[model samples]
Every structure is written in C-alpha cells, then in structure tokens.
Target: MSTEQPMAMRQIVVSSAEDIRVERVPWPDAPGEHEVLVRSRLVGICGSDTHACAGKHPFIALPYRPGHEVVGVVGAVGPGVSDLAEGDRVVLEPNLVCGKCRQCRDGRYNICRELAVFGCQSVGAMADAFVIPRDRLHRVPDGVSDELAALVEPLATPVHAVRRAGVGPGSRVAVLGAGPIGLLCLVAARAAGAEVVVVTDVLKNKLERAQRLGADAALDAAAPDLVDQARRALGGGADEGADVVLDCVSGQSSMTQAIELVDKGGTVMVVGIAAGPTTIPLHLVQDREIAVIGSLMYVHDDVRRAIELLAGGAVAAEDLVTATFPLERAAEAFAASIAPDQLKVLVSVAGPG
Candidate 1:
C-alpha cells in the first residue's frame, strides 16, 4: 500500500436546514477495487445544493458534501483500475446507473431505475478528497480552462435537454430563467443553430447578462404583456411562438408559460426541479400536441460531448464562472451562490491536483 499523506484539510459541510459548516476532514484513502481517489480541484455549486441545504430538495440525505458537478486530479487508483493512473487531471461524470435496470438495458442509462448522482447520493467533491469508481472520470483536455472543465457536468444537462427538445438550425426557442442552468440552456440552444433564442427572467441584471451571453431577446417575466412580447418577438401569434421552450424556472407560472407560448407540436423541456406538483393546462397540450420532456441529469455521452464543446470553444464555460473560493471558505461560497447577480460559484479543494 502507498503511504498516506498528512495535514488533513477542511471539508465543506451541510447538516440540515440551511446550515453550512466546514470541518477538518481526512485525506481520502486509495481506491478499493474499481475505485480511485481524486484530490478534488474545482467543485461548482448547483441550485440543488441550495435547495438541499434549505431542506427543500427531495433527494438529499443530510450531513453530506453537496457538490456533484466536480473536477479533480487522480491521486491514487485501486486494484483492478486500468487505463488511468495517478496524476491524471480529470472531471467526474456523477451518474451511477444500475446496469440491469430497464432503462439501462435499453441504453438510456440516464433514466436508470437506480440512478445516483455523485453529490446527491454519495460522498461529494466538496471535500478535499473523495473516492469514486474509476469509470466515473473523464479526462479534461489540455486547452480547456478549469472553469470550463468544472461546467462540463451542468453544461451536459442543458445540452441533453436541448437535444431531447430537438432544437437545431432555424429552430425558434425560448429559455425561461436567467440563472446558471437557464443561461447555460440559452448558450446551448444558440449553439444548436437556433435562428432565435429568447430568455426570460424576473431580474433585469440576469436578463442583461443573458443578452450579453447571446440571447436574441431578453424579456422581463413580470411585465404585464410578457406573453404578448414573447409571442410578438417570435413574429406575432401563437402560430409564430417559439418552436421550443425550455423551462429553467421551476415555478408553476414559468412552467405554464412555457407550455402556453410554444407553437403547435413544439417541444417544452423542463430543466429545473419543481418543489411541488403544478397543473399544466391539458387544453393547451391537447390543442398544440406539445411534447413535454422532463430532463434529468446528463448521461455518459452527454458529458463527453459537453467536454468536447468546452474544449473546442463552442460553449462559453468560463463566462459562466463568476466566483472561486478556497475549500476552507466553502460556506461563504455556498452563501454567495444563493445571492443575486452571480452565475457559477466554485469551491477549490485542491489546486490542479
């Protein structure tokens, strides 16, 4: 066995109900069997982390490290691990799927019955070190910025959503919300060759950022004529409304609005999580035959392709990076992610480890 390192570091912690703490944690051990120990470098905060902290997330189990969208370096590999070794710079793909599930057998492992996301279901990268299955990692290319590498996980999500929405050249799309995920959805939709992509948000600052990020039009959701403006921007009536609508805001209002404004037969992709059930107008669905697709986390190929997009400069991952905090100051970082006017916040556990 290799000798263990000392000087254990702080682990950003979440106990329950908006409580955020940091505690000294031991360096992770070498992998066991098919696992590898990653010295985590950059772990970005997701909306789910905030919700999880507030006890609003349904999937969370407390006293957990809460960052799943992670990037790191391979420090040790366990027995049976091959093709990768120590010192490899990598980013993690967090989905752990049950190979025997129906969805897995059909190759749609994204929907596996026993699917488990890294931060949500296991020890996460918010800590200084963590062990994960070796296969969960993907190598980050040489030119890709650490900021971009950190976003590959979330980027893949919106990419997967847009793909399922069937967006491509000339598609008219609307992305609801201007938060991190919504903004990423806009970038992905635009990259998909959409002729026009509009983004909506209640905050003007976020809307302005969305405009700067290449949204063809940014609308204020609180406007009295919000729907009218969106429809008019798409060219004038319901028939001219967006060919696809991505609902990045999980509230009922935004959800219903996405369904209401798309053209007949258009697709509506929900990229956000709903706190509770909200009824969609069955009449609108029956009339338009709109395809409502609920996108979960990204699949394997989605993560790979997202990395390709980042490495090739197609996706503006770094633009999405707003703040970086040392792992010791992780509580402050998580609090900042909840504040307005920020995009992506990252906790740095290990420096390019």
Candidate 2:
C-alpha cells in the first residue's frame, strides 16, 4: 500500500486595492468533456489587470483572479476533445459569452449582453494549472515563441479596433497613448496599409519605444501644440487631421484630443477602458460628423489575425514585453505593470514552453 500527496497549484488573486495574494489550491481534476487542462507558461498583466488591482475597474469587482492574457501548454485533453493533445501550445481567448445573447447570435459575440471575462469575472489563468473549455483556446503556430504567443490576447484588441475603424491604404492614423495597446494598434494599422502613423504619450521613454516600433512620428501628449505636431507629422494642412484617431488612453483629455485630431467624417476608435464617466465634446462630434465608436474585447477572427501578425513578425513582441516576474512575485509583477515606464509585464508561470 502506498500513500501519495495530491498536487497543488499556486493561484494569484487580488483581494483589494494593491493587495495580491497567492493561494495554493488542489490541482484541477482531469478536464471534463470538451475541456483541456493547460499548464500556464506565460501570463500578461494588462491595463485592465492594473485597473482591477487599483480597485478602479468599473465593471470588474474586486477579489478576482488576475490573468486573462495567457500562453499555456496542454497537459491533458478531456473526452470529446480531438484537435488538441498534451504538449500542444495554446493562447486563451478569455471571453466567456452566452450563446443566446443577441450579439452572440448575430456573430458579434465580443459584446454579448451578459459578457464576462475569464480572469475578471471568474477564475483566470494565473494558476500553474487550469482547466478551460477547448473553444476558448487557440493553438499557437509552430514558429511562434512563447513571448509572442503571450501577446496574442492584447494584440487582438487593436486588431478589432483597427478593423472597426476601417483603416486601409493611404489612411492617416494617430494613436493616443504609447502603451502596449497603442503600439499594437500602430503595428496593425501600418500592416493594414495606413500611409503614416503618429503616436502620442506623456512619457519620453514610451514615446521613444513607439518610434522604435515604427511610428512615423512620436509626439508629446503634454505639448501645447500637440494637435499641430500631429497634423504636421500626418502630412496634412494646418486644418486637417488624421483620418482615424484611436484613443487607447480613453481619458477625458485623450478623448478630447482624439476628437480634435480626427478629420471631419473620420472615426475615433475608443480602445481603452475608461475608469469612470468621461465627457467628450458633443457639439464638435455632431458638427464634424466624427464617429466615436467604443471597441470592446475581440472576436475569434481578430484572434486569428493577431496570431498571423505575430507569427509573420508584423507585430514584434521583443520591446513590448519589458519585464517578467515569476508566479511567486505576482504582486511585484502587478506593481511593475502599473509603473509608468513598463509597457507589458508578464508573470512567468510554468516558464518557457
């Protein structure tokens, strides 16, 4: 007769503002039907995670697990799962949706009426091992590295936003914010044939990073003549502005600047989650006929496109992921994520795949 100990995994949770705790929970049981057990390799700390950690995420309540951006290796596949097997690398889509919702039925499920994110609204992939439905996992291409795979979730948002704004050949684009999402937006827009891309941020280091990522121009958001500088970089007349302005910051000031820097009949894709009610220029929006669109999470097509872009080297992950921490130091990872100097902070779970 032999006695063995059950396996346990470390799960990170945010109980309150600036409070992150790691709890040891029993390893998940063998996945049920249509589910796959995944061992996390890399998990990213996104803006939403930072906001949630600070108790400012309007939609996400506190005491939630904190990992949505994930790259994992399949440990086991439940019955009825055929496409995936142990050792397969995958990226999590993270959006939990209700199939009966109007948006879901209409094929726009990213905005399901009762949409709940995996990490925000439920148990997330911050654990060393987790079981998830097969539908939520996308296989990573053979050539894609773990770093790039970890970035798919974040990149998908900008892909959806760019598609929503219809950025195409010769279009002039100005992205407000040099964060991960904004830099990814620049990459997506340029790949979609945007003639020129200008990025703005308050931090000099972020602006410099954006330039390195191929921004035609990087400007100081605090500059009094920011609008003028953007217009000049966009190669237009004094009165003209960019064809599309993506407000990745989505703060009151950035919202106002987005409207001010978009050409008449253009679109403003709000990619960032606002902390609270933000007032934009209604009269200007009405008079200029600018379409202010709010972009939420992405659909699977966006995820597929993000994979292709990352795999093809269109979206470089080298500079975007500035810092990485082990699972034991998730608290420090969250702190670094909110740091003004960092772009994307990752928590190494199972480490390299």
Worst ten in a row by lDDT for model 1? 1-10
lDDT of 2 by residue, 244-288 (tens): 999999999999899999999999999999988999889999999
TM-score of 2: 0.96
Writing each residue's lDDT as its tens digit, candidate 1 over 1-353 gives 23466667656779874567777777666679999888888899999988887778878877777778888878888999887878788999888887897899987888899988888877677877788888788988998877789989888999999988899999989999999899889878877888888899999889998888888789999887887789877664655788999998878899788877888888888889888888898888988798888999877888887888788776666578889988777778888898887889998875422
Off by over 4 Å in 2: 1-5, 351-353
| TM-score per model over all chains | 0.94, 0.96
Residue 345's lDDT within candidate 2 is 91
What lDDT does model 2 reach? 0.91
Candidate 2 deviation (Cα RMSD): 2.5
